[model samples]
Target chain A: MESLAAVDARLHRELQSRYEALVPVLRHGTQLGGKRLRPALLLLSGAAMHADRTAKNPLTTEESATTEDHVVMATVVEMVHTATLIHDDVLDKATTRRHVPTINARWNDDTSILLGDYLFAQSFYLAATLPSTLACRLVGQAAQKVCEGELRQVLGRDWLDIDEETYLDIIRGKTAELTRVSCQIGADLSGGDEGQVEAFARFGNDLGIAFQIADDFLDLWGDDDNVGKTLGTDLQQGKITLPLIRLLRHDDNAVAMAALDALRLPPEDRLGRVMPLLRKSDAAEYTRKVAESYRRSAIEAISGFAPSSALESLKTIADFAVDRRF
Target chain B: MESLAAVDARLHRELQSRYEALVPVLRHGTQLGGKRLRPALLLLSGAAMHADRTAKNPLTTEESATTEDHVVMATVVEMVHTATLIHDDVLDKATTRRHVPTINARWNDDTSILLGDYLFAQSFYLAATLPSTLACRLVGQAAQKVCEGELRQVLGRDWLDIDEETYLDIIRGKTAELTRVSCQIGADLSGGDEGQVEAFARFGNDLGIAFQIADDFLDLWGDDDNVGKTLGTDLQQGKITLPLIRLLRHDDNAVAMAALDALRLPPEDRLGRVMPLLRKSDAAEYTRKVAESYRRSAIEAISGFAPSSALESLKTIADFAVDRRF
Candidate 1:
């Protein structure tokens, strides 16, 4: 835990200087307060590799791209994550995110959209300068996957007719791909072996899925005040999460049936009542368990990697199953 | 004219395979029958170092990244152009472009926006793969400049406060920056040396400004059928083009004041009428000379380069001042 905190402090310190100039205060997108999970994952893996290097071909402090590479990778991952958030806010017509105005909410859509492009270009440019072709490919592939995920979300909206397999595919593309790449990119860059890279990527993949499902569960069950976003945001937007998908497959209870009916078309202001009805449907518990399963699998994914302090910190991250609050 | 046709033919031949699979509707977008200006500048300069290697570097034949890079750069420049159009359409809310339904007109404000992001990402991913740091830096910087230019446009919009120098600066950022980088990128990859890269970049810079002026002229003077875009689209959007700007500064005529009033606070339906009054004020002729002035300068920028058939072809593109029907 001490090591994790130190690495995170390092990441925050690095991200600070990027704001040397006075950028305008625009509301409505990536307001900079989220889990910082990607950066944490990136730095931890890099730190792990740095430890591994010290045990073998250790650095003489001056030769370190150790922390520097992690910071840039962390910052770059955050940028990719930000770009996705900007676009997703537009798609979701989401008014607020992390308690701040989403870019789509503040600026006219055109400016917000171009701003997203600007960030994406920045991310790519930074990634290009990194030492590995593998890093660039990971970041680039993640970006492409993010776009694909959005398109799938658009196509799947309110279409209860779409299956669980289809739903899982969309979630993986949107949520898990970048997270998986985050681990691979950090480890692979910091001299992690192929085996280590593979294990961490698998861990990230499972964690990303579990994290997203946990968020979905919270959207229905948690207090909106703490979540820092509107309750039933997904349902109002007609996005079907795993819990609802699982619930629909089972009893098809009257309440569940009604919620599904709500998605047969576009939703307009009916969610105040629909939210409670949705809660009564048992979808929340089912979703929580599904998320727990992914968290369990993510922990298992890291088992092949030798037990190290970095692996331990990753276990705490996995313990974030329904446990971490934004 | 014959050379222009040849370049256009070469462009089509190059696009035949990579984007033939693209939806026919989007084909006009990614493969507008423009001269292959950027890649030509690259291939032409790539040959400058060793003319024989020009054959070795047949931009069309080179397999490393030619198809993806060329198409991506082409698509990106067009995407930047399209994002401008989407914003332009929102500002203008005008209906047609290239005589087809604009995204803004075809879809609502929001969808046109996200679609623009989609196109931007697709183009960006293509550019991110080049093996040169210079290429990534150029693309990233140009993208930021485009955003800044648009922001400047939004701010300067009809303050009657814009000066000729400021106007030129705007065009340099909005249009010329991308054009200049396109050539610079082409030159760098083609193995053009430092001096050669500077010459091509200068050529592109001058050409971009000249092209913007010509476009400004065509907005007031050209026939609609030839341009495939509406006449006075800039005026309809309340954009203060060079013609209008010059008239405001120099003309004290009663008609000038009337035109200014219409421009300053334009009527909803009356945007279509400003063109005729603008024409009557002799603004069109003045704008043409302004455009031609830049064209002459652009030709001078090429004088530093050694004479060759490719250089001769490059000159023809700058000659677009008098030759373009639009």
Candidate 2:
């Protein structure tokens, strides 16, 4: 938690600039608080790996990672995540995020786009300050994956046949890739061995997939007050998420055809028609089941690490990834 | 010229990706042929510095830069330029660039924004592959400056008192900064001493300012076909460029008040009113003179280098920066 506080402080410092036009927008974007899941994962992974290594070699005097490195890397991860959220708000035309007006709402789409770009560039600038190009390379590659996945989603907005596998692939690139890179960077910087790094990456990937599924579910069914943002946007945008996909693949032919018809209607009307059908089917339960499966896998991936508070936190995060309403 | 060809090939190769949704947009963005001036400046700076070093020490066995290094750095610079253009098109709502439909026009603003982000990430990924983080640091810093400049321009769209110094500062960040970094990276990678790198950066910065001034001049006075893109966008968008600033500062109080009133008119009508007033005054000549001054300064920055074909090319580019129609 203290490390997360450090990340928050560092993020504010990094966002500071002489450009008065960007300062207010940057503050608003970062202050629209969500769970700092990515940075927390990075810090916890570094702590767990460091503790495991130290436990294994009580007499060895290997140098552990400095708190500065963990804080910097966590800040970098959070910046990338925040940039994507700002751009996504522009694309979705959503006004509020975390119960606050988004950058796009408070400013404009042009400002949102430019602010996202500024944050992205700042992230790379901070990453390059590290002793090696490893962080830069990983963050760059992960950012590319995020864009590719978002592009795929935008292009496939009208498609009616998006299935479970395609949805998984999209989320893997869009959400899971960054989390995977975050954990891997943490483990590697903390001097974890190759296998430990790979294990942490796996944990992150599964946790990220589960997190997105929960997000998709909340967009469909959760209370707006609890979610703290706009809901039903996925349905309005004709974004075929796991629940809709499952509902469309219903066993009853009439139900399936009706769901297809709902998607074909105008965006404003489609949500009303689709929600009732989704509620009648087992789609919500099915979505939760899949999310829980991924959560279990995430927990199992890190089960081999030596028992410590950090390891316990990682497991708790896996549960939170699928269980949280917000 | 062959090196430019190599830069083109490297750019095409770098834009290749597994995402089918992005391929066509990336191709369209990159293939909208601009002058490629940034990459050319980089290559010329590197070559001039290399040739000067070799000539100065014929007996020394100092290694020269490989073609691959030049090509990669040039590609990185061009990618950054191309990315900014795509995003700018969205902000300007310009339908055509280089006589072709912009990505935003052909697809949409969302696609253009994501594609720009994709290219930005790809540029950083490629930069990180180099032997050092120098390129990443410089490019990241330049990109942040660019966004800052653009943001300032957007936020100042309605301000009537934007001065010459503010205009210069905006252009310095939005346009000159990237060109400055391009030359700096080329010289640094090609083994130019620190002083040489700094000199090349100055050359780039001055040339970029001259280039932008020429661009503003052409936007108002040049034929649309000759400019190869939509013109008068700055006037339509209420962008206060250098020429416009000079016009507003004209000694004739009546003319300055008329120009201000024209800017206050609706965008569709303002261009016509402003154009007639601007043509009646010496604003065009003043803009040209300022651009020519920067051009001379750019040329003077590199006059100390030893004589070579690359040096001649740099001077020619400085001339072209101010004088070209497109």
Candidate 3:
């Protein structure tokens, strides 16, 4: 808790000075009520790996110094996440996010767009402070994948022909890529072996995919009061997620056509009609099952690590990520 | 010319496989007949610095290998410029740019925004591939400044209280910063001396500021056919550029008030009403003088360099950047 607070404080301090005019918008975006999942994954994975190494030998000065590096990297990850959220609000025309007025809504689209770019630049600048350029390279590639995934989502709006594979690919790029990079960097910074690094990368990817699946599920069916953000946005925006994709192919396309018809109606009418059909067609159940499989794989990947608190936390995170409740 | 063509070809080759759907928009943005000034500055400065070093000592294997690094850095700089253009179109609601339909106009704001992000990520990825992290750091900071400059511009729209210093600061961030980094990286990668690197950076900065002033000039007063893009967009969008800022303060605020009033009119009538006042108030002349001074400063910054072909070309570029005709 102390380390996390320090990380958040660093974020606030750095952004406050980075652009004085943007401090308010930056604060609004960064201080939003996020779970900070990516940074937590990075810190925990790094600390766990370091602890394992130190068990064999006393903690080296250089290794101990990485406590500072972890905070920087964690801040970078959160900045990246916040940047996406700002742009996502603009793309979705979202008025409120995290129970606060969005940057786009409070200011305008132009400010939101440019502020997002500012945060991205800030993230890259912070990431470059690491000893190796590997983090920058990985994070850059992940950011590219996230943008490409978003482009695909925007281009494919209201798309009916998208299959399960394509949907999985989109989510992988949009969500899984960043989480995978986060874990990979964590392992790399901790001097984890190549196999450990690879396992954590896969773990983060599988867990991220499962998390996004659960999010898509919650967007329609979950309690808005619990979610703390807008619900039914996917349907209102004609976004085709896993649930919709599954419902599309159910019962020889009958329910699929009905689902499509329901999407075309007004938001209230559409959700009312689609809710019962989603339950009856097993789409929600199917989505949850897929998430469960990914979660199981995420847990299995970390089974090779030495039993430790971080490894245990990783296990809990996999389950917590896909759990039905918030 | 051959080197620039190679750079463009490399850009196309890289983006073609990056994202299939994005290739078209990428081509549209990158191949829109830009002057290729930033990359040219990078390549010229690099080659010149390299030539000077080779003269002192026989080229080592590593020294000879920067041909690839130069190309990569040049590509990265151009990618940054292209990304900004894509986003600028969205912010401006521009339908055309560089005599072609803009990404925002051809597709939509969402695609343009995401594609711009893709270009930015691509730039960073390419930058990180360089052996030194300096390019990444400099370019990231430059990109941040560019966003800050843009935010200031958006926020300053239709305002009449801006001073000359603030206006210059805005252009410095919006325009000069990237070019300055471009030249700095070029010299840095080529192993230039501290003096030589600083000279090129200043030269790039001055030249970039002049270029932007000329662009602002063209936006209001140049022939639409010669400029090959939509004109009067800044005025229409209430952007207060150098000429407008100058005119606003001229003649004890009389012409300034008239200029402000003219800006409130429709696009077609506004240009007609403001053009004569701009000329009468000497704001146009004042802007040209400012641009000319920067051009001279740019040339002066490079005066210390040996009488090499690249140095001579740099001098010519200073003049060409601020030339009245495109």
Candidate 4:
């Protein structure tokens, strides 16, 4: 629970043969510095099922948990995460990823898209080996939800009237569902009861929703050096995040429509005028408070999960997503 | 066995809800297409397994000589094929597919990518509900082979020096695997003996390899109007397909190198020179003979399958792939 090193090592071991087969591509393509939060959730949730068990992967030494279960679950979580990023890079027109050129940037659109599907099939190959039907269904349904979220987001892209409900629905699908399933499946694979599994899943969803709200916040207000994303970048892209949505609702002035209309201005000319409009309307503070409320709600949701070191760590991870310096 | 109307209808019926959910996207995206060739193979193979049994699908009015065994087989086979297309579209950077704007083209890359994954998961869900674990494992292994094939293709892209053996390996992984497993799993689901299942699988693999080779031929030699794919498109992309590979030996000559190098030239000039250089060399004739040889091998392979109406239809499909006229 303290760190994901053992799970990471086990995942690396599973990837050994594939990594070798795909050495040149893996070495160059899949950068290896991710937090592996999903895998850790899987491992930790597995631990929570066996009372008083430490959440760190025991696959390192004399292992009790099935090797296939642990390794497959870990790899699947990573694969799902990677597949999303592959698509995300294209959607965001994100040229740089992990300080390296994205797959789309490097290989053009087709190969990048196909590679994402390759990772997906690889993930399914891994998941199909799990010991439980429940695990398979859980993973399958989560994947389905993620697609729904993506479809909604695509529709929302140019909707200038976008609001919190649509935004929340997008985040729930995009971010929360997989995180929930990751923990829930790990618990199921570990022989956990339905109640415990459901609790962990709920915890994951609430945390993910809050985590996303904060990410939206950082896109506007956070320091660029620390966040590593440009401030007001979302505005420049003409996205109506929580703050902008709130500003649209809060203003009662004569030029409110004109101020809202500014979002449709050319992206290159966006930021200069929008920030002051936001400040005059008190929208930024209102948005931050909404995010903070979601954060508190996230903490409250996990209270349904009983006390454990793993539960505590989950809380800490959520807090770090919002409050960390970097 | 003949046209797979019953099984195809069943697959359509079972997938109606998911397809309905995807309808808006599908209308924009076209999952409807040319002959559902892969699903036909699966259904025909399934029919061969239980020659005397009565099976039925309520969705179809077609009087099937073979029952619902083909239905399950068809669904699973289509899932695998659809999964591959989703991935391939990404790899090919194909914005338009089956005469419709592609999912990747209509939706941004991420939605299309995830939708593919969702389909894959749905395939596994559909596969797991069937009669055997062996079927699941067979399909799983085939999916892995696809991943390996794609990764290998990326590793060897634009090599120009790639030989026939390497090309065969890539094609086997990319195309033949799902065909092999599709036939195998279908037979097994319908209670075919071990030898019968294995034999049918081998036949399907050979057929798939032959079909791909002929398709490659069509890409080069057939009229653009007849083939529908852009003319000499593979050469333009610097893809080292069979003809391209065979021609490279003669390509050491200045005229050939001029054509090979023309990929970097202006698009019109590039095709003008490359097309004639390819035609003048023995590459076209050599690849044609190779495709004929594979088609012959496929016919020979099916000789081991138990003789039945279904088996005869399967043989016709393979012949249709290689020698048929549009």
Return the TM-score for each candidate structure. Answer: 0.83, 0.97, 0.95, 0.86
Q: Sort by TM-score, best first.
A: 2, 3, 4, 1
Writing each residue's lDDT as its tens digit, candidate 2 over A1-326 gives: 77899999999988887867667777887886478989999999998888888888766737753368889999999999999999998998989888789888888998999989999999998999888998999999999999989888877745687889999999999999999998999888888889999999999999999999999999988888888866788878778799989998999989999999999999888878988899789999999999999999998999998888888999998988888863
* Clash list (residue pairs), candidate 1: A28-A101, A28-A102, A28-A103, A29-A102, A29-A103
What is the alpha-carbon lDDT of model 3 when measured against the actual structure? 0.83
Taken over the whole model, the C-alpha lDDT of each candidate is 0.64, 0.88, 0.83, 0.67
Fnat: each model in turn: 0.19, 0.69, 0.61, 0.31
Most lDDT-accurate candidate: 2
Candidate scoring better on lDDT of 1 and 4: 4
Q: Residue by residue across A98-133, what tens digits does model 4's lDDT show?
A: 567787787666556656666666666667665445
Model 2 chain A worst lDDT window (10 residues):
A58-67
Please state every model's RMSD to the true fold in angstroms.
5.1, 1.7, 2.2, 5.0
**Count of clashes in candidate 2:** 0
The digit string of per-residue lDDT tens for model 1 on B1-326 reads 33234434443442232212223323344433244455555444444423423455556444332334444355445455554555455545656666777655754554454445545555455455555445555766687676666656664435466778878888997888877887676556655668777877887787888888888877667888988787766765656788877767655677777766777665454455566676566666776777677777767766765556666766777786455864
Task: Please compute DockQ, using alpha carbons, for every candidate against the native two-chain complex.
Answer: 0.31, 0.77, 0.69, 0.38
Give fnat for candidate 1.
0.19
Docking class of 3: medium
- Who is ahead in TM-score, 1 or 2? 2
